[model samples]
Target: MLRFFFVLAVVVPWTVGQPVDLEREIREAFNLGGFPSLAVAVVVGDDSPVMEVHGWADRAAGQRATRATQYRIGGLSKVFTATLLVQLRDEGRLGLDDPVSKFLPEGVKLPADPRGARYITLRHLATHSSGLPRNPVSRTERESDPWNGYSVQRLYEGLARTKLAFPTGASGRYSNLGVGLLGHALGRSLDMPFEDALRRKLLAPLGMSSTRIAMSPAQLKSVATPYARQDPSKIVRAWDYGCLAGCGGITSNLPDLRRFVSLNLRAGLSGVEPVRGASLTELHTPQRIWDGWSKATGLVWIVDHTRDAGDIVWHSGGSQGFASWLGFSPRWKIGVIVLTNCGRPVDDVGNRLLRQALKKYRKLSPKFRAMAERLVPHLVATPGDKVKGLFHEDFLKDVPFSVLKNVLSGLAKKHGACSRVLRVDPADRPELANVVFQFADLSLVTGKMGVSEGDPAKIVYLRFGR
Candidate 1:
């Protein structure tokens, strides 16, 4: 079993000078958004996660929102479903390239193009490249009941009548139907319900007992009362996903979701079944690029790669009357979870809070300025040959100078040459520094540089972008 030895309940201490009014900020958001209730948890590095709850769990019942309050995570359940699929793949139960038809019910036929059903694979489904629509339900049916009146038999019937958006694996598109199908098929493969299979393979091992599709009596009482976004006084009914629960039916609280983020931060390196780092890495790696690389999709995780930092992996979900967002940056080892009873777009709130925490916690180091001072000249003067000499030999192994040159050249072409080093600030890592530079066109760029521990401490990591 995975141990919870690191699950500290203590609050993270803030630096002496930089006092972040996290609770105050969250309260303001809750009040301004007119949400019924809001629960937020932030996990930074090895320190304990900090949680803040505001407003009412159920205004009519006179109950307050608390850390223990549960909310339906909606499509965030896809993250869990995807994780379960990865676990099964790692256990050698199935292959990612296996065709969808292999696991589907006998009568269910997923729509395909001229190439046919054989081209659709679990890999394509997980990556949302299976050419499936967002949902099998029609617009009129969805308007009447978004989650209800949908069943496995209906899903199969819908597939029989539906059409593919494009050739399988030809492009990227978001598809709840595709991921939901993957989860359903995996359950059939294991001869178990998707909920039970996910609990055994992922949730139970991680001690996420509170996250589930079916709420216990106690959980039902603790769950925040769902409400319409435009009218908080109007209560909304929770969804019952039935056979399609694999897509977006799980309800989870802040703590359990925090643990989920922590697991991803560790890259799933240690656990009972011990999800191989390679498998988790595959989940985080970009499987398809979209909108000219502005956005990318990993298995089921949405990935945003920052040139100077690392990848920010995230997912957001919305049920009839609940909205939730979970996001983390692997490079910074920081994550945020936002849950609310009101059905509204709270992603901006989560994103802002995460950016604030990242800015506050990731202080720049003194060593960074020195490295940037030395490298800036070459970085600005020559986008090509000479810059390679400044990088450590070992650093070249992880990233070739050619790749670095291309990145720097691309930035320069867009923003113009570096005119001056504006400031050098502390970074989260001791060996790394954050440098702000003013370009010839007056545009600003934040550059990150890290050095080795040798006598010379040659530059090992270099990245520059907005």
Candidate 2:
């Protein structure tokens, strides 16, 4: 007996075979996920974003978030590091198949890596299974800024004390130490600093005005304060990893990322080439298995998969005070970039926003829908389903069909008067179709039960389904 309300139209482009307003969907999802400050961009092409959405980029100052704001591109630094290695390969200074010993100073030996020290190639470092310890230098440095001064001498020093557990090329383990070596290899091969090589090879030619291998003093002044969590009320400063910079020292804002995505969509790692196609496919191609997630290494890029998200070529990085998620679909030519200064979990927020954008902003294939449907079995339901359970036995079962219908109708009117009903429709159960309620920040709910479970019918739930 829930009052009937308008159903949501598919918001994507008309050519995609459905109607949806992806921007509104993205805004709604961000709010639901309780992100205090969020910036979302949908790149239709390399040079421009077809859709952009922002909310409370700075809640304390009452600043509205915009697509122009920047965020720290965490582990994404691996992309630049790996890109530099590929560029070096193209220059014929070395081969992708070259061993670490070839580029190292005489007498310096990398430890027996998970890949045999002699058997493990530079490609393994680019792929992240060199199997160096999780982090080897943080203990001697300031805890708040652990990687600032680690060096080849220090790395060699650590290797002297370090040991490997897994066989090379047989499995993969994520190691910042491994990717850092890729950067080290580049610096040695090119006879310049790691950061400088990136400027000449990747960022400079791409015309990414806002992207950088490191943050300049001038950029810090204008940087948006990142939230400790999605709630904007908590603002905090970020960390600087000096030696780890090769793996995650780069910082970028939305505009620069949008520019970077544009280049990626066009070049697919060819950069600007006399090279006909890619020898760089391994970055996005799967390399190992991790439980439900498969790991792939293309240069330094980490690739994983999901049911509905096709070959999600993406990555997210987190430093002490900030977190970031950047990803795109090569098939759809659509990418989403989310920036948050908070250091904790933000992937759920990022994923929800990305799904919403895909729903309306582009022409998705049937496979996308099939993938999403498959995802349903994987979701653990929130407590909200209780309302239907309670209503089925108590509120819905006894009332005379008409009177029960009227009561639900009246309740719907009451809730409607108090809050806006963005859309309404029949849900899974046919018994009580007139459920009406308002949305709130999911982060705020913690473990609260829906009133429909037993408290009452005031709690809100939305219809998302097959």
Candidate 3:
């Protein structure tokens, strides 16, 4: 099988002149969906020609989110921690197969009682196959520290008491506990604190000034306040990871993140002299294969593909009050980063624009390009009255019939064909409808074509076009 840089060309385009305004679309997406603000940075390998900002950083103060605005990048922090381990292996400081026992305190070692512990290697942790629990440290999160105060001391304490759920190296399971332990152990191996080790080993060299597990005093002033989008009108508190900063505790702005994406997309071919292409390949390759799922885990990068898009290396993060996503297709050398203050799901947000943008770049061809140009501008200009709250929040939220009538009127106005999705007994679920929407010849955009729940939750297309 090929090891590095699989070529992935855009296979479809959703439209012609699909809303080319990313900045406006980003802001509108957040605002319409009740998000406070967001920041985005896009790059075409090493050169970041597409950086933009939208909305407020602090909703209360109305501070605008910008390219330099600092944001809490939740689970996206895992990718950074994973990359450090790969670098250590490259530098002879660690081995991919090293056991957790090699670097941790003796008492914390996997006991002889757990037959599977012995087989767990650094690869297991990186691949999430150590049989560790999700938020094993969640004990702390459930109790006093919403951030899960699993400090260095508590980490060692927990490890000392840790036991295996199953044999190590047998399979992969996504676990915050596994990656968090890796971060802490690497610090111990380096004889430095996790914060210092990450900075000295990765950040400084990569020139990522704003990327850090813990923010500096100067950064604190600029950091965006986190929020949750739940309505009833109130402020949501920030999340705490206690000491498990490796799981998701970093704060960074889009500028610094652009560097990470650029580096990954080019396969670390940074300067004129490419960095070891081998390590980059290892970072993007899957350490384990689960079930029949083709997704691969390379350190922190998740290599996933869709029939329409291919080999996208990506990760998304969500904490108490923030959500973020980073994805790039190395084949095309293009990447996008989305950081939002409100803890709204980012995958849906990122993918919505991802395909649309790729098509506009000519990455996709004539037949499949979306026909959104003639109608989208007018819709963007009008009030959200027709589609207001009509766009399904999840595959679950119900939309009003009035919204549909409005959309039918819209298609007529645009002199285009209007279509409504009517699902049969076993069909109307969100999972199937979303895939069918792009092919539906409707003047308005919708997330899905059917409903699953009842009444307030029975989600229809939840869209209006006219």
- Over 307-363, each residue of candidate 2 has an lDDT whose tens digit, in order, gives 444566777787755677777655555677777656755666566666655554545
What's the CA error at residue 315 for candidate 3, in Å?
0.6
- TM-score result, candidate 3: 0.70
- Each prediction's TM-score versus the true structure: 0.78, 0.66, 0.70
Q: Compare candidates 2 and 3 on lDDT and give the better one.
A: 3
Question: Where is model 2 poorest over a 10-residue stretch in terms of lDDT?
Answer: 441-450
Cα lDDT tens digits, model 3, 378-441, are: 2322334534333345422233435444543444444334243221111122122222122224
TM-score of 2: 0.66
Which parts of model 3 have CA positions greater than 4 angstroms off? 1-21, 111-117, 142-144, 216-218, 268-275, 362-466
lDDT of each: 0.77, 0.57, 0.63
Off by more than 4 A, model 1: 1-19, 115-117, 138-144, 268-274, 363-431, 435-449, 454-466
Q: RMSD to native for every prediction?
A: 10.2, 15.0, 15.3
Model 1 lDDT vs. the true structure?
0.77
